[model samples]
Target: MYSSIYTESKEMYDELKEWRRELHKTPELGLELPQTVSFVKNKLTELGIPFETKVNGNCIVGYLGSGERCLLLRADMDGLPMFEESQLSYASQNGNMHACGHDIHTTALLGAAKLLKKHEQDLKGKIKLLFQPGEETFEGARAVIKEGILENPKVDAAFAVHVASTLPVKTIAYGTLTATSVFGFKITITGKGTHGAMPQNGIDPINVGVTIYQALQELIARECAPSKEVSLTIGQFNSGTMNNVIPETAVLQGTLRTFDSETKQYLITRIKEIVKNISKAFRAESKIEVLTDIPVLCCDEKRNEEIVKALNLMNAELKIISGLHTTGSDDFAVYANEVPASYFMIGAKENSNTIYAHHNPKVCFNEQVLPIAAAVYACTALDWK
Candidate 1:
């Protein structure tokens, strides 16, 4: 039953690897991905697939088949700002890195597109391919929606696959709440600057920044329920420009993650209050801003069951991982929030080499999982009821 799926996917395995390598060599960042966009466009054109560029985004959407029911499959096309140290022959010479395996995501979707286009006549419904950018900045999916990528035919359901670093190849992992909702915030504290010799003359924004940080931690510890999960991290703190001179302003940036919506809102509300009160006590004026707030990605139970059944036909293991949720966030939440959506993780761990986590300079991915992911995406789109 699954012979044809694997055979077709295997045929594109070489092309998929080449695409992944080429993309790995030239990783682009944020909303503007000129080279990445061009590469994907050329491939779509070569496949004789009809597509539209910039559904008001720095991305492209390809369409195949015709029917009342439409399904959207998404692939994020952005790279992190970190430098690569993997030292592979195809390793990026440029500073940017595809440390999160987005290159694999893009290529797998392309592979599935090729497969689906060849069998388009057999398909009963329409398939919309969303090649999105700026996922790293958590703005791509929202931008795709803003540009109306889900309209015209109006998507009924959606699907996406993210690569997993630790799970072994060919393993499929998913859950009800796959990931936590996250909010990125920045707090700026302003105070009087003074020479180090005259400490009393300065309001000391650095001291205020540290106090706020500690207070934020306490909010997590004391206010949050012991059974619930929430994380608050201060990733960046910038203050003094010199040893003797106290900087007039201190900037604090961090992230908040929670699994429940009420907890998420409560944390955000408390965070603002904590920062405001702490700064006021230190006699410093402060402002807090939320850079981005991505909702928790919840898989549609019906859609997830359909995907799991479809994948099982290809002889894949569908693992319902419990209490293994990730703190990291994805803008795919934006799409899932709008439609019946399901996102799965494809295990790509190659045990021989040292495993480096995502966003690390030395991160590596198992290319062998490329065809598996392609097959799963194609089969899920094709076999869904």
Candidate 2:
């Protein structure tokens, strides 16, 4: 009943692609998406749809129809803080880029919005469109929820889509449970500076830093459970400015990911202990700070089944994947924690070896799947009873 809604509007697919391309050309970052927000608001107005803006900074919410079985569909609107490297005519300007395919996600939601508005009479319940910002920093979803976007209408089911490059085109894959907990840690060690010739005059911060890193490695490799997948990576390390002189302090920054809350907590505790012990052995003072903490994302099995059924009816390829959690994390888990939710991936890769991963300046997606994504999103909402 839903797939037929777009039969005569095939041209809208091209129009949507152009819109996506335009968004890609002028990318905005985090909660500061004025241009993007204005564009979405303008589109809703053009279609005669009603919407509310700035529930949370750049986030925009729109409502269609009136029913008790409320469904929430979300799309991220912010771009990365990196510069664009792709040579496409629609490449990002102003040094902001959609390295994570949020442009496509936003466009697909818009396409779905158009179709849903046209078929508003056939809908059984209310549908809330969440155009969220600051996803790159993992703050938008929580902000929007805190602003009462979910409480006012009280969503029964929520769905979100991410464009994936690993899966083939026209194929949709979703993990029943995805990694939800992610944390960033900053370890700073302070020691006494010394001249190169004096071995005992002062403590060397770099040496202490290295020892702490090795200790952390052992903690993860030997202490953590073998079955649990966890990552402890030190992405940045800085100390000393001169070759002959020791620096007083060294900094270590990295991220940690886990699927379980207990394991996540254990990891954090172990990291602190390791750093403390290492610093004591070197007679240095150390501090460990947690920058961010996100819970794990678990898809509602019932909602997932409904989504699969809808996709099947639309003649779309579907695959159920397990243990496919990436090191990356999303604040979308914040909403999933409170309500039944499903986050699906849309294939964006065109070639096996040529596609780049997310957060890279060169990352790009296959625009041809925009319509397919929009169709799936619309169909899922249509079937959500």
Candidate 3:
């Protein structure tokens, strides 16, 4: 039965495709995933996979096998807070969309749960299924870790797969330094409220915010080395309401990402110093709030070799590409930092030139990669030493 993992996963294609489309329709966001959790719970129950809700109710943990060595297979179950423009019949009408292909991630893990459960007795070790919530906000994994989501069984290794819309279908890419660390922040600038016409009476916080934003951007180009992989992006800026009244405060939110820890620390210190000194020069009060701090997703090289070999042995026809890395961040970084772990990207793009990247409203993934991902998840676990 274990030898037929790839074939069986392919046989379940229609069922897995339905699961992905249904999940794509009713996407949830943040730590609160009510309907999404309910659907996962029901499916897990039907498959006779026992699981317990932990942390935020929907961040569930399902069990398989009972040996000393355990492998954690994680799937994030949250979506982005954006409207879908993809005119597919099952496109999400709700304000939220699974533009990141997390729907495919969750469904592939479920398909793995089904396959692993069918051959539980032949397994040499344990496989822990983590149906995590709040990945987009970077809160779910931290909360779960606090409550000991990794303690009860103490996993030896972990694995995760993300769907990529730009790569050809059925291609699997692996690498050592898979993703960059991220530090998300919000800066608040406070200025006195006054009539807009009386510009002399009030300090302009918007001006201070604009200056700080510019300084932050320049840090990457001027302060950092050209060879270092670093980036800064300010996504949101909110200030005044009325045209005649000067607002009391302005807020700017942004994220900084890099692969080097020393570089990350240097930038954070510079950011704080820049904000403090810039606000003082502008005669405005300011405060900086830390929103998220995640480490770089550094895949274990030896483990990567083992998993890559296991995957090829599982399906000889499967394409295994190497040396792919990105600056984008994932909270799976938290898990990889804790244990010997590896991550893979399975290609999910349709055969078309217009491939929209992740988080795009019009993004679509090839459903054919669903079973391939499921097979990879299950076979990787079953074949692990």
Candidate 4:
């Protein structure tokens, strides 16, 4: 039933692999993706798809078909700030890496654009291709939304796919509750600096920071219900610069993840209270600020069911796995919140050896999954009612 889609996607496999590797080699970070944008623009131009570049960020929206009703397929174009350790021939020489598989997502969307263009005459409605930037930091989807990517013809639904290294290649994972929402925070503890030996003369902000960090553990452990999934992780702690000198300030950077909005608010309130009270107890001053907030990703049940049914009718050899969810957060949640959206996970695990998790320095995945993802994107756009 999906033979033509496979053949077209497979025909572009070599090209898709090259695109992914090139993107992987020259990974860009955040919204300012000049090289990456240029590459995608060149590809879009070659495919003859007309696109408009957003003025705010490096967001590119391309158009295909001439119908009225529309569907959108999005692919993130930015890489993480971490260094690459994949050791592939095309490994990034720069510090940045596509550890989150945005490279594959971009390449797959490019291939999908190619496939969809090949069958444009058969498409009943229009398809919008969004190549967005800065999913790692700022919510690029929000930027895309602000720029009105969902307008013009007006998209009826939106869909995107993320690559997972742990799942075997050719497996499609779906979930009702797709991904957890996150709140990233930076807390600073301030106190007077003095000689390291004269502990009694000045307040110790590091000690206060430690106390606040310890108290934060109870936010999820004791405060949140046992059945609820909430995680509080402190990723960075910075304090004294020298061994002997007491630092005047200590900064703690962390993220809070949860599926419940009320729980998210509770965690933030408790964190502020804990930091303030803990610092006051130690004769220190403190400040807590939210750096980023990503809403939980929830799929439209009806749209997801329809997409699953469409996938089942396809002839692709991939395994279709449903009812899957992840603790990780995605800025795509921004779009899912705004419109009827369905986000799926594509398995890219190549071997049974060592599966590296996403955002890891040595993260890697099977390139063969690229065509499958592209096909799914193209078919979803082509077959959706």
Best by lDDT: 3
Steric overlap count per candidate: 0, 3, 0, 0
Per-residue lDDT tens digits for candidate 2, residues 269-313, read: 888888998899889999988876778888888788778877777
Candidate 1 structure, TM-score to reference: 0.96
| Number of clashing residue pairs, candidate 2 | 3
TM-scores for all candidates: the values are 0.96, 0.92, 0.98, 0.97
| The candidate that achieves the highest TM-score relative to the unseen native structure | 3
Candidate 1 lDDT, 190-293, residue by residue in tens: 99999988989999999999999999989989999877888889989999979999889999999998889998888888888888888889899999988889
Clashing pairs in 2: 180-295, 180-296, 180-297
Alpha-carbon RMSD, candidate 3:
1.1
10 residues in a row with least lDDT, candidate 3: 1-10
Tell me the lDDT of candidate 2. 0.82
Off by over 4 Å in 2: 6-10, 193-200, 240-245, 316-325, 351-353
Candidates sorted by lDDT, best first: 3, 4, 1, 2
| Candidate 1 residue-wise lDDT at 226 | 71
lDDT of 1 at 67: 84
How far residue 16's Cα lies from its native spot in candidate 2, in Å, is 1.3
lDDT (tens digit, per residue) of candidate 3 on 1-385: 4348999999999999999999999999898889989989999999999999986597889999988988999999999999999888999999999999999999999999999998787778988999999889999878888988778899899999999999888789999999999899999999888999997999989989999999998988899997788999999999999998888999999999999999999999999999999999989999999999999999999998888888887888878988869998899989988999999999998877788999999999999999999999998888866
What tens-digit string does per-residue lDDT give for candidate 4 at 7-31? 7888888999999999989999888
